[model samples]
Target chain A: MTSSWLNGRPCDGLPVHDRGLAYGDGLFETIRVAGGQARLLDRHLQRLSNGCRRLAIPMDTDDLRNELTRFFQVLGQGVAKLIITRGTGQRGYALPEPCQPQRLLLGSPLPAYPPQNALSGIRLFPCETRLAEQPRLAGIKHLNRLEQVLARAEWRDPVYAEGLMRDMSGRVVEGVFSNLFMVVDGELRTASLVRCGVAGVMRGEIMVRASQHGLAVVEGDISYVELLQADEVFLCNSLYGIWPVTGLAERVWPVGPLTRKLQAVVADLLSDS
Target chain B: MTSSWLNGRPCDGLPVHDRGLAYGDGLFETIRVAGGQARLLDRHLQRLSNGCRRLAIPMDTDDLRNELTRFFQVLGQGVAKLIITRGTGQRGYALPEPCQPQRLLLGSPLPAYPPQNALSGIRLFPCETRLAEQPRLAGIKHLNRLEQVLARAEWRDPVYAEGLMRDMSGRVVEGVFSNLFMVVDGELRTASLVRCGVAGVMRGEIMVRASQHGLAVVEGDISYVELLQADEVFLCNSLYGIWPVTGLAERVWPVGPLTRKLQAVVADLLSDS
Candidate 1:
């Protein structure tokens, strides 16, 4: 079952003139909800706030928090997807004066993935769809996700749980729906999203937790060769917790100690939520 | 008054879960409607068709044509904006099997621009926003247009009619909502859309008309310096026909013979429509 609230009203639709549909002028957050609590909400809100500020979309964070609280009470356990659009506009790219930003909240039942896959590991498909390096639009989970959609469309095999995408410069950046991390030379590293790719909230949380646990986390460019040569690799998002990537193409990776340790950390966090 | 039709039915709203709003998984076209005829419509449909093919969005061109004909009959004289999205999905980037493409057509009064814009010329705002190179998406009139939105937002001054944008590599690309052309020495030149830019339909028409009229038309890389040094420059889109660019920052150019010739050609075409 799914439920939606548009601007604090129980609604399943928005005006067709909404800029989100017209120009993808918006930011979104897919939050994990458990036991009626939104997990890592502050991080999600922080990212949304940063994106909103960059896009100059007016936001009242306090009001949003209250609305989310109310929505979660009915949501209980599921995923809460929040979309903040610049709202409806006339025919033009210019920002509408007195912009009425639209806030949409959708609650859906958590996806059912094979238990054994998460327990063992998942394979990653090498996607050909490259992420365009746009520094201004990078990092934020904006609505302009056609690249991800194309990358995700590259495969239909259920065995490949995710598709790994590289940037236009052929640097391994991230998975279609998650952030990627690899253990290289006994150091934890993830591609810097300064060029392209969405900065997942879980990825941020893991970086913080890993550093607190005494792991050196580095964020920089990671070439495909570097990723293939890494000791271990994994993918993460807010809802799925963590899934160790055991294979990409023909290259195989063992669920190394770092992957296991971080998985445990995330598992605990999700459980506590 | 604005009128809208969704999938051939009168509707003002769409489901919030529609991928157009969620991920911008769609293509769009803004066509001019005059005397109950859609101007440059074949070219617009051709571009839309190409974009749909690239994005793998199923489209029935014949059906779309019939729908547009019906829409324009009621619209009479206005601007017709058409959007075709990948439709609703189940919270993932993966293409929905048996995807239902949603077609939306909106009619609105033509923008009341200062008549002097076409008669004399207009100034160009040097936008800081740079278009990111993504070959797969380059030339298509896709829904992911936040860059244009941002560029347009750079200035609210009514004096600067349009903003000129460049690629990340500092190559002059196009206007915020139009294609740009420059006359260098004796040849007509427009920035190549192969790297990053929307290939405007009116641009194609102008190129064809210029070539038929014995002018050398070239589409390739154009540096900001090259544009400023050009003998003449102009912007083109389906709606407004052509607007000769008079100035950019401190640089200025006269409305040269080639611009006037092409403008006359477009003016005739629009008038016929």
Candidate 2:
């Protein structure tokens, strides 16, 4: 990381006793910064606040916004990762009295991906690792991400850029670090995140955009067979706006018209932010 | 917290990039150190090794044993916590190439609980938070423990000593930080950790001692109804040894003979260790 900050001060380390390091009791947001501004930061903060509410972690939105502004102002163009954890505590499962949340901000140069990934598309590895269903933790981008770490380790080949993960009941969930959407039977469909999956801000953007474009957006279960039958498949995240899935398993998909249009719209929206 | 060490060095902080703080991609063990010896240290190490194998994190058992011995030798009486993270990384879910696991050891004064907890018994609050079933993540004490934190946060009343957590399927699994056991039909039974629950070291010790005593130990599904019907209910952890459950919801259970006997055996085994 090029630049980092803990709380409001510049630092490269965190207290080992932070609950985030101890029990993954935390939430993180990876934002794309351009021209010294974190793109779609409000959306990210909205999601973060929702997570804090769901997890019962007290958050001061104004203070967080001020810190984010300060952290992003010094960066020209890069990815800014923000982490908020229930602060230091003595050993025990119970929450410590007078808990104070700790925030860590990091800045890193934009990762280099092949040009073809955006123009042509990327391939997917059908990961054997499945996401567990926990409704309480389903839609929030909290720090309990061992499943994603395990899924990302399933393949080392450069041919596959991302891995597709499914829930235990054989329902396609999402990508390792992105949301999955498919154009099936001329309808835009994505798996619901109510059971198990991080509800990405980019996903919310796409659903809204699809609705504006007069496309039927279905947030429900999409079986592996159903996903296979889709005319187009795509993965999306805040950093990587969208990548059409050119290949998955034995099947292949083309960069369909809807995907191309959605990509263009998302790029425009991100640039504006 | 009295003292701390990171990678055998006296330190109170970990790098912000540590995977343990980021994704909770690690395992942890809290051992009770008494009289300059960590009680049930071998059992703790065995469970930690099992966690390492399950999570695919490389561990050198001999080196870890030596480190633990050195760490405990200087401490007379306290709770020692050991955390092994997948170590530092750049940015992404994929494991860093040639990953070196990070070890953090911390010592804290043993918590002071009321004497009545052990002599009379403790009360339980039926937690609203439910544990998700992921066999791959189950039975091992990994760092992804937000579920326990959430369950423990359900009530602020000091009346309930420990909250009882049930699985997503409504099976009485265990407590927030300990294992649960019940005596039914003159048989020693406990919820199976096969689906979702930490296979605690103390729980293992109790199981072995019960079997040696010629008791029928049943590890199977335990519904709420079954839990209520149990002649006796008790909770056990390495630190406190055992605490019989005098009340759960509206039901009450007596401090039965089996609970007393198992507690005595566990205490003896721990003392010997």
Candidate 3:
């Protein structure tokens, strides 16, 4: 069952003039819930706050946290999707003066994925839809995600678990719904988010954990050639933890030790509370 | 007063799971309604139809036209805004299977602009916000318009009637709410929509009318330096018709003969029906 709230009230609809729908003037976060708690909630909130600041949307994070605490009790063990919009506005693109940001929270059952996706591994589709270079809108998870929707639409075959997207400059950036990482010659590497792509919560956590474990994690350009030449590649998101990418097109890879170690870290983090 | 309809029903709200709000997975068109008629509606519908095709959003244009005829009568003389979204969906970026497209029609009073804007011309603000190049999403108006919102926000000073935006490569594209054109060396020029920009219905009309009158209408890249060197500049949209650009930062131009010619064409087009 799915439950939702608008501004702390149990509602399933928003005003037609809401800027979130009018111009996609908003930000969103999809958080994992386990043991009646929102996992990595601080990171999610931090990202949300950052996005709000970047877009100039006023938000009271303290109040948001309080509301989520109550919401988690109702959600229990599931996924919490939160959207913060500039709220209802008069016609036009000009930011509403004295903007009243709307907070929407929805709790839904965790998506069921095949067990083999985490164990044996999953296949990746090379998406033709390229991420446009826009440093101004890069990193933070804003609502302007047509590129992602188009990329995900490129395939319907269940054999490919995810689609890999490259930037306009032909650099391997990320998956349709997750951040990507590859183990390259003993160095852990991921594409830089300076030009484009979302700076995912799990991606950040993995970087920190890898660094603490004395691993060299680099964030920079990763070409398709460089990615295919890597020792191992993996994908990560807040909900599913980490998915080992075993195949892309005709190439195949065995689950590497580095990916296993990081997956274990994510599992421990998510299972704790 | 502003009134709205959802899926041909008199409603003011939508389900929270709408992909329009979630991912900006939709297209929208703002049309001018005059004398109980939707002016230049066929062109607007054509653009919307083209957008729906590119996004793979199933739409019946004939059905949409029938609905608008009734809506225009109710609207009388005002602006008709239509939004076609991918409708409600489960949490994910992938296109919904068996998708139900939502048609939202909003009728609101025409925006009141300074009379001097049309008579004497208007000043333009060169926006710092740069449009990202994406061929797949260019020309057709989509809902992911954070860039426009940000650019419009750059100037609250009413002295500047509109803001001009360029692409990442520093090629001047369009106005915050209108399409831009310039006259250089006796030839009409507008930024090509192949890279990135909303190809406004009025822009298309102006090009055709100019060609009919035996004027050289060209669509290609326009650099800031080239724009500054142009003999005449103007901005246009379906609602406001045409506003000759009298000034940009530290520069000014008289409303030239060609601008007057095109403005007359737009004025006649909007006044009829």
Q: Would you list the C-alpha lDDT of every candidate in the order shown?
A: 0.92, 0.89, 0.92
List DockQ for all candidates.
Answer: 0.89, 0.81, 0.88
| Residue-by-residue lDDT tens digits, candidate 2, B1-273 | 477898888996899889998899999999988777888778899999999998889999999888888888866677899999999987898888788999999988787878799789999999999999888889988999999989998988999999999998899999999899999878999999998999888898888889999889999999999999899999999988899999998898889999998888877644523
Residue runs of model 3 more than 4 Å from their true location after superposition: none
Candidate 1 residue-wise lDDT, A1-273, digit = tens = 388999988995899999999999999999888888899999999999999999999999999999999898889989999999999876799999889999999999888877765578999999999999999999998999999989998899898999999998899999999899999877899999998998899999999999999999999999999999999999999888889999998899888888989988878656735
Candidate 1 backbone collisions, by pair: none
Fnat value of model 3: 0.87
Give the per-residue Cα lDDT of candidate 3 at A59.
93
Model 3's DockQ score: 0.88
Candidate 2, residue A71: CA error in Å?
A: 1.1
Could you tell me the lDDT of residue A99 within candidate 1? 97
